[model samples]
Target: MLEIRTLYDGTGALPAPSLTKILREAYDGELFFSDSSSRPLIVGNFVQTLDGIVSLKIPGKSGGADISGRNEEDAFIMGMLRAYADAVMFGEDTFRNAPGHVWTAGCVHPTFEKEFHAFRKHVGKDSLHPLNVVVSGRGHVDLDEPLFRHEEIRSLVLTTEQGAARLHQRYGATLPAMVHALPGDAALDPSNMVALLHAEYGVKLLLHEGGPTLFSAFLRQSLLDELFLTMAPQIVGRSRTGERPAFSGPLELSPEQAIWGTLLSVKQAQSGHLFLRYRV
Candidate 1:
């Protein structure tokens, strides 16, 4: 069994109970979130090496599994977070990285599937799985990917006007996911995307599983409210620009504009992986 030891928890008292006892025990503590009414509460999850490398950029080994060394505890924590989110989102490149992956609690950690479903049900989530959201500014996505064809996962694509036109021209009504075009040519505004999810889909909690580029955009715009970071005990050195990428991507923040995060909770697994929660 995967075991997590809570090292510190500073999440102030909240009104709503988010996790079930089963999940709490497995996680070694309770989980809570402050409510947001203006826009969808956006949270990002990432696992990085000790040296701050998020991906090795290899042909077939670019996913988090390699970074976390296939740690089951990290997967369980990610699955638990997915259970709390109303929608799970990622950039197009993230989808391309994981070709056949599904953004659901059960898909990530089947051992805790029942507990995840029970928690979601108790929290009044109607969908069998959380909505899958993909952000593709240029619409350079492979529509035939397994996630697009998932019957249970209602997928939504946020794209630019030009990209939407391209998608319509190529896929038309045959496309299984809903494509929403926003006013832009290259990059869609993160705030606008959050507003769309909050106003249209009632997405109170959105989990961001990222490719570094998308994460840079969100972080630059200050759109991410919380971050769940898994610190894997590895030292993957990045020698080149494209081979190994940092978690911050290309958006360099000046000292004056640098954002600081407030630590909410910290947990450690037996395998020396650290799970950290931060309010940004």
Candidate 2:
């Protein structure tokens, strides 16, 4: 097991796995948004390589373990964030990569399950499990996957009208609680989708676990608040295949549309990975 040491924290200097104190304060509604009006504060968490690869463009498989080395510290932090969130959100491609997975705290970070749930209850989450939300403009998801079959987690889908119709044909009767389609031909609007999640699900703090393109959408929409990024100690160099970077897709934040964030916190695990937090 790798231990964590805080190099710098905007709040104060403190070490981690004892980092829970910092997380606890954030969970107490102190760190999200001070404003009264907004469509829920959006936070993103990801681990990437020193060379900036999140996952390789392997033919049919997707995993960041090769890049991140599957560090224990990262897993524990991931679980902590899931517990802190009202819902753990993912893009369809990322969810599809793990066919047998659920987005619940236990599923993402099982070793920390007991403590993770305790923290959830500590933060006064009405349900023990955070909702599992997947974004897919075309509703490209595995209806038979464990994301739906999991009894504890609530699941929802966001897609286009035509995609909804197709999903209805395959999973009409057994569809998850909601299948919200975008208006007209407007594909999936990250801001609008997030606003709906806040209005409908009472999600005040949304956490995004991404597959590049989706992260790009949030960036394009300026809906992201905070980012927890783990800088792993490997170098993926370049894609042997035409792979994507940590953020993919057509959405661009050009020079005029640049998004900048202030550095907030930093930590280092024994494995030489650096964990950084940013206020975006």
Candidate 3:
């Protein structure tokens, strides 16, 4: 078992472990234990500061800085978690806009590709890959996107019956074989969607990588199980006046169930960035 500790000095570097290894450890370390009592799915979230401020010094157009050391480390952590998950869930907007290989860094580690391929294999049973679930209401997705072409990932677009029909006609053979049509507005029904994933696909572990709106919806429905957040030291004080954090409005967690996140670890990257993990 990995020992949990706090690093107050924030100067030393934590040993850099393979992303896949770290993810597996995180699950075996905490999630698996929790699941023994209750079967709530695990979910994770990653966000950059408004000033494009992933780092304090590398401020670029997006907000605070270019991809700072902290941002990179958090992203790598998120990637590892995703790799370990049975399925990677995302909002329709995130899917249509994000570039392919959403979590791949430029690192040439031996395990990077291998871990990703494993996830793909899990999704595409028989020759398929790890299920890539996208939530879209209008079914407005681009079939020619590189994400669909990736052999390591199979895309499952969840939309309404009308939208699914339209997408089927438009994309035809390009889309995944299964297009789930919910009873009501598909995008609005996250709980039902999660149940569908578990009941139909046997996806026991679900990691939701969000784009704010989806996060808000998940929280609203009380469907979120656990939250993994990496809080970088820098602040993004601008370019986000109107935007909201993933969770907005009144927090609904009960006093006992109210969020009690345990600090997992803190690591400083070679680029002088800090990575902090909390298990909520």
The candidate scoring highest on TM-score is 1
| lDDT of residue 124 for candidate 1 | 82
lDDT per model, in order?
0.89, 0.75, 0.54
Candidate 1 residue spans exceeding 4 A from truth: none
| Top-scoring candidate (lDDT) | 1
The segments of candidate 3 whose C-alpha lies over 4 angstroms from its true place after superposition are: 1-40, 50-70, 102-111, 115-129, 173-177, 238-241, 244-276
Taking the tens digit of each residue's C-alpha lDDT, what string does model 1 give over 54-116? Answer: 998887898999999999999998998899899998998889889899899999899999999
Model 1, CA-based lDDT: 0.89
lDDT per residue for candidate 2 within 1-280, as digits (tens), equals 4377777767444332332454554322123333225677788988888877787767454565555787877876777778878888888888888768777777766767777777777767888888888888777777888777777788888888987887998888877657888764535878788878888889987889887888887887777888888999987766655565775344655788788888987888878989888888
**Per-model C-alpha RMSD:** 1.3, 3.9, 7.0
Worst 10 residues of 3 by lDDT: 56-65
- What shift in Å separates residue 247 of candidate 2 from its native position after superposition? 2.9
- Provide the TM-score for each candidate, comma-separated: 0.96, 0.88, 0.68
Comparing 2 with 3 on TM-score, the higher-scoring candidate is: 2
* Residue 9 local lDDT, model 2: 67
lDDT of 3 by residue, 176-216 (tens): 44577776654558777877878777777677776556766
Better of 1 and 3 by TM-score: 1
Model 1 / residue 135 / CA error / Å: 0.8
